[model samples]
Each structure stands twice: as C-alpha cells, then as structure tokens.
Target: MSTVSRAPKRSLASRLPVVHQLQQSVGLQRGMLIAGLVVSGVFVLTAIFAPLIAPFGFAQRRDDAGIFGAQQPPSAEHLFGTTVGGYDVLSRVLWGAQTALFVIVVSVILSIFAGVLLGLVSGYFGGWLDRVLVVVCDAIYAFPSLLLAIVMSIVISGGQSSLVGGVFAAAISITVVFIPQYFRVIRAETVRIKAEAYVESAKVIGASSNRIMFRHVLRNATRTLPLIVTLNSSEAILTLAGLGFLGFGIEPTAAAEWGYDLNRALSDVTSGIWWTALYPGLAIVLVVLGITLVGESLNDLADPRLRGRRAVAQSAGVVAETSVVPGGSLTAGPGGLGGLEDGESFDEHGIETR
Candidate 1:
C-alpha cells in the first residue's frame, strides 16, 4: 500500500488536455509571440550595442565626394542609403534606436511607478481621494495625449537641454496617460478581490488595512499586470514618437532620435529623398507592433476565460475518444464519463447494451 501510494504519476505536461480551448479562443502562440520577441530582441540588442555596431558616429557625415547621391537605394556600401543631408541613414537609424529605447525605459518606469502607487492608494482608500483622482484622470484623459505632450513641451522650452527636458516632459505626459488606466483597472480588480474569502479571512485574523490590501489583495489581483505593462510600454513609445514628430519631443540638436530625424526629413520628402522619413517611420511602426504583439500574447496567457475554454475543449475531446464501448453500448471510461448518447442502458454485467 505504501509503495502504491508513493508511485510516481505522469508529469503535469502529460496530463494536460491536448486541445487548449483558451488557446483556440485567444489564438495566441501561433508564432506571433516568437516573431514579436525575436524582432523586439534584435531592436533592443541593436540599441544596447549601438556604439559598437554602428559604422559611423551619430554626427558623422561624409564629404561631397564620398557622400554619394541623395535617396540612393539600399546597397552594399550604404545600407538604407544616404539621406539628403549626406548622413548615413542606417547608422542614424541604429543610433536612434538607443535614444528611442532610452526614452521608453525611463518614461515607462516612471509612469508605471506613479500609476501603480496612485492606483493602489485610490482603490484601497476610496472617498475624497478617489473622487479627486478620478476627476484629475478624467481631465487628463479628455485631452489628446499628443496635444498634452506639446503643451507640456512648450512650458519647458526655455533653452533647457533637449535630452533632459524631453525625457522629463515625456515621462510626465506618459504618466498622465497611464495613471487613469492603472487606477481604473486596479480599482475594479481590487473591488472584486477585496470581498473574496481569503481577504475576509485575513481581516478576521486582525490583519491591518495595509497588510490586507497590499499582501493579500494586490498580490492576487496582479496577474493582469504584465499585460498592462507591455501595453503601456507600447503606448509610451508611440507618444514619444508623436512628440518627436511634432518638434515638441527630443530637440533637433539631438542627432540620433528617430522622431527628430523624421521631423527634419519631412520637408525633404518632396525632393524624392524618401529614405529619411521611411526608415524612422518603419522603426517606430515595427517597435510598436512588437510591443503590441507581446501585450496581446500576455493577455491571452493570463485571461481565465480563454483558459476555461481550453479546459472544456480538452475535456470534451478526452470524453469523446474515451467513451467508446468495447462490445455494446457506449459508456464512460476511466476519465469519469459525463456525456451519454440517447437510449444507452447499463446491464447487470456492468456493460451497456443497446
């Protein structure tokens, strides 16, 4: 009896249902995740190793003789070709990744920290504080995020260093956009989880409000946070790019920014020097797409509705295959049969005969 009890069972992976219903519903992990991660990883690595990877410095330019013609198509010598101003477009694009990624990292960290703090506080201590935050978020949300960024940029445009000023401006504006989302999501989740049995039990055990909210409530409610973070990261990237395009983002003097480059090249678009705008635009689109895919995959993975669907499908399949009768009418197999066909009856021999 002891040996039988101690016998090793099949691994969890082997026991898992073959057809994942949630996977079907969400349609996740069908290569979007892999492709997104691979592309995003390449971009991140390029940004990290920009100094070593770029053949030319961000400010480097060739003289007339070596600069070649403007808007030249991609070639072995000048991949992505040279811009109208004789700058290496590929090198600039590579360097711009660093600037773009830097802003993304800083702004996302600040925004997430601020949003999460405000959300936690507002949700846990509802009343005047919640009302005030709601009002503030509503006001911010009313304005277009890009317009708000421009307004903030105007306020800070007093000969300040573009890098420092632009980062500060982007961080603040992105924080405003994100706080409302965080507050709303966290509040809803908190409200639902706060009344759960575990939370009530904790309260009954004399747990403080802070302990209950942070330890028990927040912990249980955070399964959706990774998806939120991924989505917000993409939003931050778009906002930053928009600010750059409007000339309110990283200053023109900052030579390696995709937004700044795009803005500079906008006028030259008429000269058929399309590479200038095209490269940066493509970079922005790819980065945003990658982030979006990652967020979508994470959401699919975390969503219980999808998981439950997958479970149902798997159970149904198992039942269908395992329900076959050996000689007579169909009956439930070892998997604990549920579904049964009409007119099926069990005889005293423990067999079903039509």
Candidate 2:
C-alpha cells in the first residue's frame, strides 16, 4: 500500500476569523464591553426591581412636609427633591423609571415583532405585499414621528390624556415609525443573502420558502440587529419624553412620569428652582447617552471591515521571500525553495521519487 501524507491541521486561533476580527475592532476593548454590560445590567435591574428599589410607591402620596417643600434642592431627606404638588420628586423620578422602562420595553417589543415580520414578508415576497407595506410605511414615515404620535394620541381616545392611553398611543406611533427602518434594513440584507450559496442550497434541498427565509436567511442576515434594536429603543425613549414635554404624553395626574413632571416645571425655570426640570431632563439625556454608547460599540463589533484593520496591520509585520530556482524556473519557500527539476516533487524528503 502507498503511504498517505496528511494535510496540516489548522490551529484554533486560525479557525474563527470573524471572532478574531471582532476582537480587533474599535470599541471592542475590554473597558467598553464592561461599560456596556454595566449599563444594560443597571437598566434591566431597575426595571425588574422598580418596586423594591424605589423609596416610595409610585402612586402613593403623603400629606407631610415632603409634599409642601416643593423644589427643595437635593438633600439627605429627598434625593431628587419635591414637586409643586407636595409630591416627592425623588419618588416621582424613581417611579418614572418604571414608566420609562415599561414604555421602552413595550414599544421595542411591538416594533421588533411587527417590523421583523413585515420586513421578512416584504423581502421574501417582493410583490404586491411589498408594495403595500412600503406605501403604508412610507406614509407613516412622512409624518414626523413625534407629530404622528401626538396626532395618534389625540385620535385614538378622543383626547383622553390618560397614562394608559398615552402609553398605547406612543407604542403604536413609535412602532409605525420604526417599522419602515427595520423593513428596509432587513430587506436589503435579505436581498443580498438570498443569493448566497447556503440560501441557494437550502432552496435546492426542498426546504419550504418560509423555513429558508426565517430559519436560514434571517439568522445569517440579522448580525446587525442587536445594534439596530438598541438604537431604536433609545429613539423610542426620546420620542416618549418629547411627547410628555409637549403635553401629549402620560397624564399630569398620574403617579410620576418624568416627561409630565418636566412639563410641570417648564414655567419655573425663571425662578431659582432649576432642579425640577434639570434633574428629569438630565435623566433622559443620561439614559439615552448610555444606550447610544452601547449601540455604537456593538455596531463596531459587528462590522467586519472595521474589525479587520488590526488583523491586516498585524499580518504586515511578517514577510516571506521567494526566488528563482536553478535552470531558469521559479519556486516559493521560506527564504526560497528552489523550483522542481523535471518530474521531481517539490518536497525535500524525495519519498515520491523513491
């Protein structure tokens, strides 16, 4: 029997190029990853334990000095101070955390479900269904998101202005605005990935269109989805805040909404009680900024071109030289392996000749 020569085994480091590339990306540093995790953890924990974490029940109010001391600067007694309604501002703010988290979670869930479903259908079908969704999405997109939300709020409940009504209105409006973005992004990705070898192979194997589109195609196509979802949640929060600021969001009488609270304090800016508006507004900004930073870092990690620059730089450090062999021929080896002579094999062992 003839001897068999085995091919060299690849090292684990060389097997997963995408992972290596991701590690080399900007903002994929250990510090950024830790910061992102911390932000996400805090937001999630605040949402989950809002009742236990808050100093007072969101809707509960007492007829004590706390309510009378409206606009007191942050102190040991009141962390965020009191509002004009003899309500504890700190309590309201803490309670508002629940509201903000609720809105974000609800709106994002709705948006992602509707958006991804519509996107997959529009992309995969690409006919009258696509046209219909595109037109509807475009119409909603044409109206400014905040304005559309305000109009929707007014239309849905005949101007009820209740917390539940406002939340539902905001959810619907935000979902509509974001659906088009998701549809477009997913569609573009689908269009490219449908032509890939794996997709084509799946089709050839008699897999159903829905299976191929959802299980095979979408899984590969949604590498950017985490970042998209993060950014959209941030946008939803800002839109909700803007509606509250404009007097179209949660009702003023409701427990404590950051937006509604900010609206109440608008007139007091001229007075020395800047803390009322300032603290809530700052809360909105900080939350938005935190989400934005995490989203940007994820984007960097997902983008291959951005991630591979460091790998390319490292590759440039090592070099191999080549030279011509004897008898007017060329070959490649470390410091030059000579060209094969006549029928001789390139290996130095000469086992083939033997």
Candidate 3:
C-alpha cells in the first residue's frame, strides 16, 4: 500500500523541470570542464600543500649569517632565483597560493551570504524596500570594481602590514563589489518565482512567506551562483594583487602575496632580474585562467536552454540509431518483427507502439 502511494509522488517529482535540468547538467562541453577542473585542482592542491611542497619557508633566508646575497640568478641553491630582498622567489610564490585561497574563499562566501539575503528580501517583498535596495545596488555597481576594492582596503586596514588585517581588507573589499551582483540575480529570480504557480499553490496551502522564499525560491534562484562565484574568484585574485601592487595590499614581510612580490620586483625588471617578477605574475595568470575557464563552462551548464538542446540532440541521435537497423529491418528487437503495423509508431523511449 505504501509503495503504491509513493509511486505517483516519485513520478511527479521526476517530471519536474528542475529534475530535468539536474539530469542534463553533466557532460556538457566535457573538454572545457575537464580542463578547468584540472587547472583549478592544481591550484587548490598547491595551496593546501604549500607547507609540505615549499622548499623553504616564505621568509626563510639561505644562510645563518643573515647576509644572503640578493638578485641571485636561478642556480642549484636557488631554483627560481632570489628576490632583491634575499627571499626565495619559489618559496614566496608557493606560499602566496595559501594567501590567494584564503582571500577567495572568505570574500566569495561573505558576498554570497550577504547578497543572497538582501536579494531574497528585496525580491520577495517588492515595495519601498525593494526600490531602495535596487537603487543602492545600482549606485555601488557603478564604481569600477578594482577602484572600489582599493578604497575598501584603505578604509579597512589603512594599508598596514598585519596579515589578518590585509586578508580582511581584501576579502571585505571584494565582498562589497560582488554583493550587488548577487543581489540583482537573486532578486530578479525571486520576483519571477514568487509568482510561479507552485509558489501560489504553496501559499494557498497555508505555507508561510518564509517557507516559500527559502524552500522553493532560494534553490532555483541560486543555480547560477556557482558560475558567478568561479568567475569572481579569479577577479578576487586580481584585486588582491592590485592592492598589493599599489602599496595598499599585504605589508612587506607580513606574508607572501603575489601582488606585493610583484611590487618589489618592479625595479628589478629594468636591471634584468626577471625571475622575481616572472614567477608571481605567472601564478596570477595561470590561476585566473583556470578559474575563468571553469566559470565559463559552468555558465554554459547552468543555461537550461543549452542543456535542453543537448538533450534534444541526444534524443534525436538515439531515435536515428534505433529506428534504422543495419539490416534495414524495422524490428523492435533482433529477428522480432519486419516492420511497424500500419498507422503505428514507437513512443519516445521506443516502447509502446501507437
């Protein structure tokens, strides 16, 4: 009896559009996705294993005499060479991975929570609150993202060398820039979904506003955020670097950061000390590229129309393959039948003649 009662519920749930979307999410642009995953995975692993992988501590000097020479070219002792400040360029680059990871994680998480919350409220309520919030978001969005980040960094830390302060400054600045984006996405989705038939049904059935917003609308609205987060993560790395380069970033000797490292290397390039600048710059480029690729692939995946097209293509291929047997027999199975009966055709799954 219970099994009988549950079957219809399962069928209804399976038929939901959301279910179809989830089913189609996989194997879209497989090559791009695989490449993104591989590159992003390398950065994540490098950040996680920085301590074990780095040959020397980020600030460790080569000798006990505390007089290590600067600008030493790549050699057996120093693989990538030494910075003008006598720090190992390789070690600093490796440790910088940790800093980059922290900033991305902290900033993205904060932005998502704040932006989603505001977006949900403004979108669902749709009153003065919504109007006011929208205006504010638009105003904030007008500023250049990098410029906004710099201002936020200065306001937060005054450009001091405290690692904690620097991290917070970078993260919070990024959050400010991204919150409006998230808000706009979720708000628009909420507005559309709040009027959805299912939402109306939930309301008619005495479901509370909170329940409808959080339970039904939130999930659908956030489907695009993974893509946004991925793209924003790459942007965050660039912002952090920009801050470091402008002297508003992590302080000298406080921690290893690519931007700060690059700032130190600006004068070296003129004198032919390439290793100091090359490694950190390369790190930024590679990481941003990896993240951008993942985001773009994810954007493609999140589009239901694209997924639906793929599904249709697959279904068409299946039909083409199944209907035309190699021996030119129209049998449902091998040696079963010669042709379909007059005015008969197979159903979509090739079952149940009609």
Candidate 4:
C-alpha cells in the first residue's frame, strides 16, 4: 500500500515559489537560478555582516596603521584599495550593501501595501472611485519615473542628509514611482479574479465581503506578485544609486552609498585610477544582473508554454508525473488506486493490470 507515496511530505516553507523551482529545475534554467542565488546570497550576507566583515568603517580615513592614503591601488592591506576620500574600498562596498538592502525592503513594503490595497478596493468596488484611481495612476505613469523619484527625494531631503533620512528619502520616492506599476497589475488581476467561479461561490455562500476579498481574492491575485517584486528590487537599487550619484544621497560620514562612491570617483576616472569606479559600478551590475536572472527564470518556469514538460524517455531514470491527483489512503485497501476501474484489475503482485 505504501509502495507509491504521494509526493512525500513537503512543508509549506519548502514549497515556496522560487525555492520549489530551484529544487525542481534542471539544465540551463537551473544553472541561471543557482548563479543568481549565489550572488544574491553573497549580497545579503555582506549586508547583514558589514560591520564584522569590513576592515574599516565606511567613512573611516584612519585605522591602527594611520590614514589610508587616497586612491591607493589594490594591495594586501586594502584588497579593493582606497577611495579618493581615503576610505577602504572594500569596507565601503560591504556597508553599501546594507544601505541598498534597506532601500529595497522599505520601498517594496510601502509600495506593496499601498498599491495592493488601492487595487483591491478599486477593483472590487468598481465605481466612480475606480475611475478616479485609474485616472490618477495613469497620470502618475505619464511622468518619467526617475524624474519623479528625483523630485520626491529633493523635496524630502536635500544634499547630505543623515543615514535614515537619506535612505527613506530614496525609498519613499521609489515607492511613489512603483505604486502605480503594482496598482495597475494588481487592479487588472483583481478585475479578472472577481468574476472567477470560486469568488462567485464564496459570495453566494454569504461569506463576509472582507473574508471573501482576503481569503479568496487576495490569495489568487498575488500569485504574480513575486515576479514583480524581483524586477522592482533591482529598480530600487538603481534608484538609490541614482540618488547618490546625483549628490542627494547620505553623507559619506553618515553611511556608505554606491552612487555617491561613483560620484566621488568621476575625477579619478580622468586620472586613470580604475579601482574607485570599477568596484562600485561592478557591484551595481552584478546585483542587478542577479535579480534579473532570478526574475527571468521564475517567469519562464511560471509559463507552461515556456517550461514544457520533460518526456519520461528524456528524463533518464526519472518518471515525472503530470497529473496532481494523489493515490488513495490505506483504507482504500492494499491497492493504491481508489478502487477498480472498468477495464483495470489488481493482479496478485498488487499492480493495476488493464
């Protein structure tokens, strides 16, 4: 009776979207996801352990050995060398990860709550309020996102703000820009889902409007959100970098920021000093590339048309199941199949013979 277990017992945590794909994927898709995961993991760990991992403070010009000379080339003492401001490049890079992480988290959270709520309400109700919201989102989308972010950042905090102020200035500005994107996508999803049979059935059952909206509608509406999240995370990083590069970022003494590092390195480029610009710019590229890879891989896997099934013959020794129905309980008797089918019978060996 136990010969064929029903897909084993996987915890809900283990069945999370990307992790499930990461576990099941094979070939090129698997390779891309692994690479992205490694890079993202490194970025996250560096952010979490910046103070412990870094050799010096982000704004520190001196250490036990004295002041780190400006624009020093790579050496044993400073692996990534020193910036023009006499701070260790490695330390700044590590600490910058923390700042980038903060922006991504804050921006994504704010945007998700505000956008999803508005979309849920607008889509569920669908009246003058819906039309007004749609028009407002369209108007917001009409302006360039970056320009809007810049204006928001300027209004919130000008040059050389404190760490929290600067991070929030950049994050909130990004939130405003992305709210519309999330709203449109979610609103459209909600509209389509509201008419689904399950939703209608829930309504018919006299379930509270709030319960129906949240329990049934919200769960299905957010399936596509993970894809949007990955894309927006990379954009959040870019927006933070842009803010710093344009001189609206945190003060160097207040915190490390990649865009500000790039801004400070511009003069060094003409001087043929490469380390200053290279590492920070490379950090941006690698982080963005990693997020983009994860997003693309998930999107491919999510689309049945793109991630076509592997035939049993092509799967080596593995036999993949297409249907999701599980085998019967032990109470259904020694055979795993629920019961006898029209032309199927269980032989002495307990196998279903047709």
Candidate 5:
C-alpha cells in the first residue's frame, strides 16, 4: 500500500484576507505586497513601542547634563540632532508615529461603521432617504478633503489644539470626508446584490427584510470594503498631517505629531538646518507610500482586468489535455467522432463514445 502525505492546513492568521492575498500572489505582485507589509509593519511597531524605542520623552528638552542646546547637529548624544525647540528629533518622530496611528484608528473605525450602516440602509431601501443621502454625500464630495478637514478642525476645537481634542478633531473631520466614499461603494453594491436571484429567493421564502438585508446582502456587499479601508487609512494620515502643518494640530507637550514638527521646522529649513525637517518629512512620506502601495496592489489583484498572474511552465512528463488528435483531425478510418456533437462525448477510456 502506498501512503499519501497530507498538506498541512494554514493557521487562521495565514488564512486572513491580506495574508491569503500575499500567499497567492506571484512575482512582482508578491514583491510589492511584501515590501508594503514590511514598511507598514515597522511603522506600527514603532507606534506601539514608542515609549521604549525613543531615547527620551517627546517633550524632553533636557537630560542629566542640561537643556539640549537648540538646533544641535547630529552627535553621539542625539542621533538625529535636535529640533529648533531643542527637542530630540528622533524621539519626536517615534512618538509622532503613535499619534498618527491613533488618528488612523479613530478615523477609519468611525467612518467604516457610520458609512457602512448608512450605505446598507440607503441601498436596501431606495426611497426619499436614499436620495437625500446621495445628495448629501455628493455635496460633501464637492469640497476638497483638506479644506474640509481644516474647516472642521476649526469648528470642533475652536482653534485650540490639545492631545485628545486635536486627535479627535482630525479623526472626525477625516471621517466626514470618507463616509461618502464608503457609502457610495457599499450602496451601489447593495443595490446590485438586492436584485440577485438568491435575494429574490430569500424574499419569496418570506424572510424578514432585516434578515434578507443583513444575512444575505450585507455580507456579500462588504467584500470590496477592505480595499477602500486601506486606501482611506492612508488618506486619513495625510489629512492629519495637513491639519498639523496648518497649525491646528496637537501641542508638543500633549503629544508629538509629525505635521506639527514640520510646522516648527519651517524656519529651520531657511536657516540651513536640515535635520529638523528631514526625518519627520521622511516619516510621513514613507508611511503614506507603504499604505498606498498595499492599497494599489490589492486593488489591482482584485480586479480581473488588471491582475497579472505568473505564466505556468509545462513539464515534459505532464501531457496537456487536448481535443486534437496526433494528425490534427479526429477522423478515424471511415467513421469516427467528428469533433463531437452536442449529444456526443468521448468516454474516460479515450475510445468508447458516450
């Protein structure tokens, strides 16, 4: 008796959507996905462990010796040099990551929940509510996102910037802009799915409207959400940065923010002090690039028209299945299966007709 070895089952984590995509991707797709993940992962880890990784507190201006002299160049003591305010540039960057992460979580969560729910309701029940929502979303879309965010931040915080208040200001503002995007995507999907045969069947079986909507429609409608989520996360980061850069962001004492750092570093750039702006600017660029790459790769892979799969090589031992005979014609002697009619097919043995 011959024994066959069974392949090991993937763990739940490996079967996760992004992980599964990574595993299934080949060649250039795989490379892009992996690179994005690595960059994103480092940012997340830096945020999580900022307290430990950073050499000093975000607001620390002095060590055991004395106050770090303002605009100090990179030295053995301070790696990335000191900011114009005498803050350690490296520590500020690390803590800024945490602040950025918090904003991203807050914005994406609120937007997804509010947007998805509204979309489902609006799409399933096409009435005055749907039209009203569509119009509202279109109006919101008319404004530039950063401009809207700035207006919202002023309205929410009244020009006062603190840790919690500033973070929420940025989050809520970004959420408002993103809700329309999610709503439109989900609503369109729901409208299409509600007319599917299975949905009609469910209705015919006397299923409750809520059950039909949630049990059948909502789950299928959300398959496209992850791509949007990734893209929006990146957008949220940019919006937060914009808010801070525009002088409506968190204070240095309350929390570190890359945008605020850049704002503070503006004068430094003119004075030929490169260190203050370079690192924080790079942090923003890299995090955004990582997220954008992930979103774009997944978007391409999900669309059949754009997805590129590696070509498979044929092995000499594995003969391909084909309908063609050696002579390129199926005519056998005087009578044979002539390219098979609708009612005829060859049997498994490759001889008898069935």
Candidate 6:
C-alpha cells in the first residue's frame, strides 16, 4: 500500500512540468486558449517566414515605372498597398510581426531575469534591503506605463536614427514596467513558502541560504510567472507601438514597424489612405487580443476553485453518497446513503424509522 501510494505521488511530481494539466479543465476558457494558440501560431509563423513570404523587402521601393508606385491602392501588383514611403504595406505588415515578436521576447526575458532575481533576494531576506527594493519598485510602478516608456525611450535612444537603440529602448522600458509586477507576486509567494516545513527542514539541515532560496523557494514561488509572462508580452507590443507612434520607433529604412507606420499614416486619414493605417492597426489589435485571451485562459487554469468545479462537473455522472460510519461522523461511500446499522428500518421513503 505504501509503495503504491508513493508511486502515484512520484508520477504526479514528474507530470507537473511536462503536462498541461489545465488544458481541458474548463470548456469556454479552453476554447479561448485554443483560439489564442491558433492566432499566435499564425503570427509566429509569419515572423519566421517574413523574409521568404513577404513579396518585397521591408523597405523596398518601386522606382521602376509600373503599377507599384508610391501610395498605390491594394492591387495585384501591391497586395496590401504601397505606403507613402513607397514600401509594400503587405511586406511591412508581415515583417512587423517579426519585429513585434523580437521586442516581446527580449523584454519579457530581461524583465523576468531581473524581477525574479530581485524578488528572490528581497523575499528571502527581510531586512532594510527588502524595504528599499520594495519602495523603489512601488515608486516606479506608480508612473503611467506609456509615460515611463517615453522617458526610457528618450534616455536610451535620444530620439536617434539607430534601429538597435530604438528596439532596446522599447524593450527596456517595458521591462521596467513589468519587473515590479513579477517582483510583487514572487516576493509574496516566497515569503509564504519560506515558512513551510520543507524549507525549515532545509535550513535545519545546514543548507546554505543561497541554495535554499534558489533551489527550493524560487521554484515554488514562480509557478504563476507563465501567466504574467504571456500578459506582459502583449503589453510589450503595445508599449513598443506607443514609442513608435511618438517618433521613437526603429528607423523605417532599417526595419518595418507597425507603430511607425501608424504614425506616418496619421495625416493620410484626411486624404482617405485608410489601407496604410487599417492593416497595421488590425495587426496590433489582433495580436494583443490573442495574447490577452491566452493569458486569461491561463489565469483560469491556475485557479483552484475553477479546477475543483471542473472536476466536480466531470464526475457529475458518478453519484457521491454520504453515510454515517460506526464512529457516527458522516463519510462518503460507494453505495447509497448508508447511515443505517444492521437493524435499522426504513419505510417506502429513505427516512429512518425507529
């Protein structure tokens, strides 16, 4: 019996990381998750194949005398249209996915590294260091997200023509905004988890603080980070767009960026050049929506109450019977209501009769 019980426990421990236990936990949320995966997968593929699938180079212009002139409407020659800058809108849109994915990946990675490090230290050691870090994080968190991004943009790029600088500026700014959220979540969990018996046992066994903090505490505390990461990736795209809209985006000649295109298209609306803005805007909206749906579904998956409800719903066909054991406390049994002893009597109804 002991070996059998330990076998199940070991299997459960092995499966936690490898299996997505929450994938089928709920119907509506799982559907949203599937939809998000489909949308995100398409964008990811677009990013990977931007160079090959895009009909034109990101900044390719049509100086050749043909139907592919500057600002031409969508046609066979220019599938989406030609932009005011003579670039192919379809190619630019496709390439923009690559740019967006890069920014999101870089920002989220940097933020997670910094945030998790600070969170682990602050949470494990509750001294003046923790207080100072907490105060600083809160102060930064108070600033409006876009405003903070703008400040970081100017600091990093000086509104310069460097493509790499603009990308880093946007990524770092998003990182700053995201770090505090990760820090707070991780810190709280670490504080609670550090007091558990296993953690105490590690301390008692002469484990170094560093080992226990990293090996034990950090692992358990960061369980929710996947959800945060998905949500933050979506925000990073928006922040990158805002930076571009304000003219702090990547240089147009160096890369195709959705936000920069939208900025250039601001005046085109008056002249009825809707294609320039519409496609990029839709790209941003759909990507963000897809990411948000994935994040929300992940949140639902992480919730215990939802999981319990889902388990109950799944087992609805199996009736659970409450019975009184010999000790007189009510307990569950496979058979129907079982409070009766050997001599107990019942009428046509299930009620007991003296």
Root-mean-square deviation of every model: 6.9, 9.5, 7.7, 9.4, 8.3, 6.1
Rank order by lDDT, top first? 5, 4, 3, 6, 1, 2
The pairs that clash in candidate 6 are: none
Please tell me which predicted candidate would have the highest TM-score against the true structure: 5
TM-score of each: 0.78, 0.76, 0.82, 0.85, 0.85, 0.84
Local accuracy of candidate 4 as per-residue lDDT tens digits, 218-332? 8989988998999899999998898889887777988999999999999999999999999999999999999888888888888876565443336643434333336732223
Per-residue error for 344 in candidate 6, Å, reads 23
User: Which digits, one per residue and each the tens of the lDDT, describe model 3 over residues 72-188?
Assistant: 999887899999899988999999999999999999999999999999999999999999999999999998998998889889887466888888888999899999999999999
Error of 3 at 208 (Å): 2.5
Better of 1 and 6 by lDDT: 6
Report the number of clashing residue pairs per model.
Answer: 3, 1, 0, 0, 0, 0
lDDT of 5 by residue, 151-248 (tens): 88889878666788878888888899999998999899999999999999999999999999889999999998889988898898888888889887
lDDT of each: 0.73, 0.72, 0.86, 0.87, 0.88, 0.84
lDDT of 6 by residue, 264-297 (tens): 9988888999999999999999999998888888
lDDT of 2 by residue, 99-144 (tens): 7787887878887778877888788778998889888887877878
Sort by TM-score, best first: 5, 4, 6, 3, 1, 2
Q: Output the lDDT of residue 41, model 1.
A: 86
Q: Give the TM-score of candidate 6.
A: 0.84
* Model 4 CA deviation exceeding 4 Å by range: 1-14, 158-160, 311-354
Candidate number with the higher lDDT (2 or 5): 5
Query: Which whole-number lDDT from 0 to 100 does residue 172 have in model 3?
Result: 95
